[model samples]
Target: MPTPWRPFASYNLWLQFAPPIGQERWHCDMKRGFTKARSREPLVATLLATDTTPQRIGLLAQRGVYEFHQDPLMLYRSDAVTKVAEILQLNQESAVVQERVISILKNYYSNPILFGKNIIKLSRGDEGFPEPILIEQGNYQFNLFAAIDCIFKEQDGTLHILDFKTGQTDFDRRQAYVYLLAASFLYPTQPAVASFYNLENQKWSDPITATASHLNAFQIEMARISQQHQKDLQRYRHSPSEFKRIFPPNPGINCQYCPFNSICSFSELEVSA
Candidate 1:
């Protein structure tokens, strides 16, 4: 018997039995633009096309939002509970996970009081945050999108924006810088102070001062990451199944939380043990 001629033979040789790796790169190669009509991409068309009349586009939109956010609380409201349960095969009604999700939602909903006495009112509207400013610097476009969990405005017109994080993880300086970049793009003239409220720790962190120089550096890093992601997505789309097989699994502790774990051979094997 002769050996088979497989296009990905060389790559598969090294990762024959390894688990799937990397983010799912679905429909990445389609030209950039939002489609009012249904997507023409083969994978997208296959998934979204249905026999139902008038089609459930709103449901599809909600699913898209849930996918990007990956928040279990949001998924529950979006009717993704059954789909998630099928994929992960985990009982969502489990006391531990349910309690954790409830606690997170409570914190998110109580953003204003979470900041304690440091809360400041920025805008007259219920939005709470100051009006966003649009700043354009060189080829970069920055649109500052922030909903103030808490805000404080001074007599001097200096505005402070506070964001709450329910998770125990501390905010990275890089994330602050990205916000600064967006703020600078929106308000070219105003000096803004950005702060993080850690609900779990019950502490308010020192604010990061936004400057033009800092925003420029953040913009460059953002562009680089965006380009790299696009490249990775393109490569994955060329052959998804083959690409998934070739790459060794980059399993994190979070993989256990994934909904698709039941169908995943690697995950099933781990569970059997």
Candidate 2:
């Protein structure tokens, strides 16, 4: 008996690299949009797998800064460009606080001691950072990309992946699972540990062990979501106007904080009205 040909095997090969000539010609018609769509899938998968400590801390800080605009009680501290310009013109005392915040951010990047072990030195002398690995299992392909904040290797060969968080928030279990999934793919039999160091609170959470079952489930979900997103992109290509109509208007809330709000008619009306 002859071996059967699998359609998915060919499809997976095409997906890993470039499309075939016929598919490429079809893609060329939607090249610009398709490029963005293709880039977004892997980016999302990377985020899922390795958006570890530094990213979480940065995201929390950004959210806190953006919250100043959305909350009325915090509006006086809004750091929006227009408000900053007005404060500068008035020679406000708050400018000093702004400068201090900027200084803190600068020092955070420049001073290694302040961050302590939380800062994973990716570059060692002339040696480069470890390259991210892209792995395919079943229907899903995701990148295992993590810049370890700190790695503790046991004499027995147990590997601990320590992540540092600058925010006061607790460790996100979902994120830890994603890291575990990536680690398992890389080191199938090795024990993996995940930890979070919250700088704001000056605390380190207990390390969490990731099980194989959890990782398998997450991988399945990722594949399904990626496929759905691809389908959504195809539908959007068929009717862009229909896709635009699906989402609701932002109203006025997003205007004051949005960087590009000045050029938007809805924003202009909301701000000036």
- lDDT winner among the candidates? 2
lDDT of every model, 2 decimals? 0.42, 0.45
Stretches of candidate 1 off by over 4 Å are: 1-152, 245-248, 263-273
lDDT of 2 by residue, 1-273 (tens): 953322121122223233333433222212223233333556444533443434433543333333322334433333443343342332342454444434333333333222222322222111223444565667555444444444555556676665556644456555566567667867678887877755344466787875677777766654554454455567776776544332223435434533324333344446545
Query: Positional deviation of 181 in candidate 2, in angstroms?
Result: 0.8
Question: For each predicted model, how many residue pairs clash, with residues at least 3 apart or on different chains?
Answer: 9, 0
Lowest-scoring 10 consecutive residues by lDDT in candidate 2? 5-14
Q: Cα miss at 267, model 1 (Å)?
A: 3.6
Please provide TM-scores, in order, for all candidate models, with all chains considered together.
Answer: 0.48, 0.48
lDDT tens digits, residue span 1-273, model 1: 953321111111112222124423211111111011114655445543442211122222222222323453543354444443343323434554444434433343344232223334422123333444343336533333444444555456666666555444556555556555555655557677877766444477898886677667656555444444345445556765644443334344434543334333344336434
- Position 176, candidate 1: lDDT: 58
Over 4 Å off in model 2, which ranges? 1-132, 140-148, 154-156, 245-273
